[model samples]
Target: MNLVKRLKICVFTFALLFIGTAVNAQITNDITHEEAFTALLAAKKNAEDSNVLVNIAVVDAGANLKAFIRMDESYLGSIDVAIKKAKTARYFNMDTGKLGELTQPGGIIYNIELTNNGMVSFPGGLPIKNKDGKIIGAIGVSGGTIEQDRAIATVGAKSILE
Candidate 1:
């Protein structure tokens, strides 16, 4: 009887594990190249009104660069920073504003500021999500004030709205 009970428990545990994996498998979202490009273009267009050169980066949920754009004669040196910030937002699934709170003078993110490939924890990065609310990617803007960067990031991410 003891052996039989153990076998039954094992079977139940396996079934539960299988079900959990299946449910979680559907939670990840994938962003297409087209979507990424569109987001970058939108960001650039919106920034034209400000006439400030900006660098934009679109990163996958894993913080991988999916696409990027740099305005002509922009600093050109800020590209890496832009990519890192976007990756930071993609990995955290939050806007850079909240990230700033965590990385502020004595915040949790302060100690690990360089955790994401030396990405700066500034307020120009925003995560991109799909209609299903799954974070598919992130967008980052640099070369302007933090607020301006934030605005560009917002419009860039929202440009993908269907």
Candidate 2:
């Protein structure tokens, strides 16, 4: 082949290789088992520090349960609530409390809680985000008042960033 033709072929081959490699380099964002455990521990610690008994739950990017803990003496009613809260955060990519505000009467998403197999529109759930600010999972806490639950859940979600 002529010199110019050979050079053109070489450049084309390099471009093809680069494109293939770039496609294969795509990364998936999800929470690891260890990270979920760390978040649960942080939430539990926050509950203990506040002298509160609570149920904590962690869910992955797909809103699937990863870890759950119910402190001794915690209200039994909070079991499902904790899981739902985590799912709610992951589903909406925002805090459950914020959803509550938006779903209230006269709000933009009024009555939205009636959908999605039933969502908790109250406090206690937060989305866990990666260093790039992409949500990778969520944390939820229940068995306490709204404020207490929100506080504990916030601590758990923040742990993943630290």
Candidate 3:
């Protein structure tokens, strides 16, 4: 083959190889239920450090509740809100703030926030991802201020891989 033709063929082959690798690299591993509960308990302990009465909820990627806990004196009113927020995080694979954005007026995905059974459109929820970088679950915290809730959820989500 001529030099230019050979160079073109090599580049095309390299491009095809790159595309194949990219597609395979997208595979992911999911977190287990045990990891989800462990993360929740650890989060609870973290929140306890601040003397915050918090309710924590964990949900799987499919937005199904996996585990839940509320401090003995936590507000009952926050339980459902906490669970829903957790599920929302898992389903959307992001933090609760993004979920809020999705539900904001004029947001393209606004109506989706209303589809889940008990999703909360507020912060304090975070998606849980495994080593493979696939989000497999989420954590939510409530019974405190929104900031405190977000802090607790952050701790919980971080604990999953620790």
Candidate 4:
């Protein structure tokens, strides 16, 4: 490459890196262990009250697993689903149900779940938000019917709000 071209490329790369770092630094990861635990407990309780067995997963702002619980008699196959659902919620910063709607055939971004290392786009995933409406984490539940799972996850997500 010419000297001028190489210099321009280097400058462009540097600017991009600097901007990414600055933007990432501004995003606060306030999802502590306590918050994750609270979400898990709340979700578990909801499942119990509903007489549903379920697996629950919680993820921090970085989309890393923070907490998980598998209730007695929950389907073993649902463990991975729960974790992936939580990750899917955090990865897109939206409820997985919404993702499901968008990924449906004829909808925008159809088959998106094929990407992102295999996401679960169905219901049972929710973003945990603070009172200010900023998402701090996410929760996912599985093993129950779609409605039951979504309800349980919502209870979990709401418990730690703010």
> 54, model 1: CA deviation in Å?
0.4
What is candidate 4's TM-score against the reference?
Answer: 0.82
Residues forming the 10-long window of minimal summed lDDT in candidate 1: 111-120
C-alpha lDDT (0 to 100) for residue 19 of candidate 4: 98
lDDT score for residue 66 of model 1: 92
**All predictions: root-mean-square deviation over Cα?**
6.0, 7.2, 9.9, 5.6
Q: Who is ahead in lDDT, 2 or 3?
A: 2
Between candidates 3 and 4, the one scoring higher on TM-score is 4
Candidate 3 residue runs with Cα over 4 Å from true position: 1-28
Instruction: Report, for all candidates in order, the number of backbone clashes.
Output: 0, 0, 0, 0
Tens digits of per-residue lDDT, candidate 2, 1-162, equal 899999999999999999999988644788889999999999999899999999999999989999999999999989999999999999999999999999989999999988888889899999999889989999889999999999999999999889
TM agreement with the true structure for every prediction? 0.79, 0.82, 0.76, 0.82
- Candidate 1 stretches with Cα past 4 Å from truth are 1-28
Global lDDT scores for all candidate models: 0.85, 0.93, 0.85, 0.92
- Across 35-57, the per-residue lDDT of candidate 1 in tens digits comes to 89989999999889878789999
**How many residue pairs in model 1 have overlapping backbones?**
0
Local accuracy of candidate 3 as per-residue lDDT tens digits, 63-131: 778889989999999998899888878777888887788778898877676675656788999998877
Residue 136 displacement (Å), model 2: 0.4
lDDT of 4 by residue, 54-137 (tens): 999999898889899999889999999999999999999888998999998999999999897999999999999987888898
Residue 114 displacement (Å), model 1: 2.1
